[model samples]
Target: MENTVDQNGLDEAIIVALGCNLSGAYTSREALLEAALEAFSSEGLAVVARSSWWTSAAWPDPAGPAYLNGVAVVQTSLDPAGTLAALHRIEARFGRARGELNASRTLDLDLIAHGRRVISDVVMAPHPRAHERLFVMGPLAEIAPDWRHPVSGETAAYLATAASIGRDARP
Candidate 1:
């Protein structure tokens, strides 16, 4: 469905995602962002804001190249489940492989938050640990600092601050 926005603000919530690990190739951050924008656009999603790519060293197994991560805000009508499904499809289209947890992937689309709805069942809303991950919060804060977690009652800035503390310590 086509999204609607009033003079006050957007009428629909925005779904955000990050595209990382580009097909085991040396893909630049801009390419990843472009692919994400194209994928979401094809699904009739509107991008309201996006952040520059932030490169980070590999983690855990460190089996692949460093990842270039970033965030994108898109307006959508799909519910959380539907949205996640769409994101998974997009990742598949980009050659994403679902292996071990934290394994290398072609794309990583995380739904940071959806308006004020706090859903937590099969698909948790606001990403259960979004606030605790610097890669997610750092980019999210750039676009939606004032956006608060419906359940935690904490702003993106607060979450980002808390997330930054142990980011470097991640192993």
Candidate 2:
């Protein structure tokens, strides 16, 4: 199981969701995600556990390229905002351009949760809508099945099963 508590008795399960439909400079979405994982370590996020890649047709538009998604449990000393900044930097490094709400991109990295935090200002922890998306919850469940939502108190596995979005997401 992924470590839930660090030596300081603080929750260490920082969750990050990754997805890519456009490969950019990389030859494949899988390679893009792999490079993003490596980028995390340089930003001080230590990956403890990672889920196998999951695939699903693009949401709200199945005509778009299918996406490769996954989740990782990371340990980080940075606060939620810092972690978010790091994720954005990693995304930018991979040619991600923020414009449309759900436009296809070379890479997408979302800070799903920072331990059990529930921050609402600047950067929201326990991302406001992640619980409703199978692309996020399904991969999260694979790595941290027992992880409970800071607000809902529901397990990752339960949320994945009950997710209303990305219903076709699969590993």
Candidate 3:
């Protein structure tokens, strides 16, 4: 679908994606990030805040190069599932191959939070793993430090700190 913004401003939401490998033909990390952002914006999502890409060692599997991760706060009318499906389509367009749970790929877009809405079917709410992943929490805390998890009731900043401590304790 062609990217277009509606006349009335839509509600805001935050989306996060990690650029781990240009597993496809694309070679630059910036290009991947731009494309992902454009895909979302094209769907009438307005980006409010963005975070700098953080380079991190691979997780779950370590064969691929370190990942470049960032987050974007967007305004959109689409429901949680709709927004997520849009992100999935964008990833597919960039040649993201989905298989194993934590395999590396060119694009990985996650619906971090959706305006306090908690959804559990097919698409999990508040991203079940958001608090535990440094790559996600770091950027999220940067943009919404005071934001509270709809379910856990913990502040983003707290979760981020916990994630950092968890990482340090790991081998």
Candidate 4:
């Protein structure tokens, strides 16, 4: 989240999913992640907690480089939109390109949740596709085992092991 806020906005906790397969302007995946965290911190988004990194096959079971994935919990005074904007900004700073769906990327930053707020604006919290991917659920479970999906009401732990593995697994 950014440091700005709405008149009615209060401090909120947010979950962010980070992943990288390709190296950006940064030298490597770790550097890209470090840069992203630095950017978040610069924006006043405090990283309260983060999951251990997990390696996973690229989506669609591609033969490309495996991606590093993790989850983070952040605290910020910024409203939902501001937080989302900050995330996009961070992604852009790392040279993320948007075009084809499911394309390989240098940095993928997804806002998984923003407190208990349910929003359906341009950015969707508690990402609709998050629960569908073991790569996401696996890391999310490591950091937020007790976290419940705002939409499906399933815990991250449950979703991580749901249907064993694979992106097509049911939660």
TM-score of each: 0.81, 0.93, 0.83, 0.84
Which pairs clash in the backbone of model 2? none
Q: What is the C-alpha local distance difference test score of each model?
A: 0.66, 0.87, 0.69, 0.75
Instruction: Kindly report which residue stretches of model 3 are placed more than 4 angstroms away from their true locations once superposed.
Output: 1-12, 164-171
Q: How do the residues 1-171 of candidate 3 rate in per-residue lDDT, one tens digit apiece? A: 212212132223445545555546666876777777777777767776776676677775556576777777777788888888878888888888899877778898888878777889977877888788777777766766766777788876788788842252111
Question: For all the candidates, what are their Cα RMSDs to the real structure?
Answer: 4.5, 2.6, 5.6, 5.9
Can you write out model 1's per-residue Cα lDDT over 1-171, one digit (the tens) per residue? 322222233223464758475544436655765766677877766677776666665564456666667667777778778878888888777777888887767788888777777788867886777677666666666666666667788766688778842264221
lDDT of 4 by residue, 1-171 (tens): 332222132224478889888877778887788778867888779887776667777777568677878777888898878888898888888889999887889889898888767789777876877887787887777666777787788877898877344554221
In model 2, which runs have C-alpha deviations exceeding 4 angstroms?
1-11
Candidate 4's C-alpha lDDT?
0.75
Clash pairs for candidate 4: 112-126
Off by over 4 Å in 1: 1-12, 23-29, 61-64, 164-171
Between candidates 1 and 3, the lDDT winner = 3
Order of the predicted models by TM-score, top scorer first: 2, 4, 3, 1
lDDT of 2 by residue, 1-171 (tens): 353323242255788999999999988989989998989998888887788899999987999999999988887889899999999998898899999989999989899888778899999888999999999999887767878899999988899999999999999
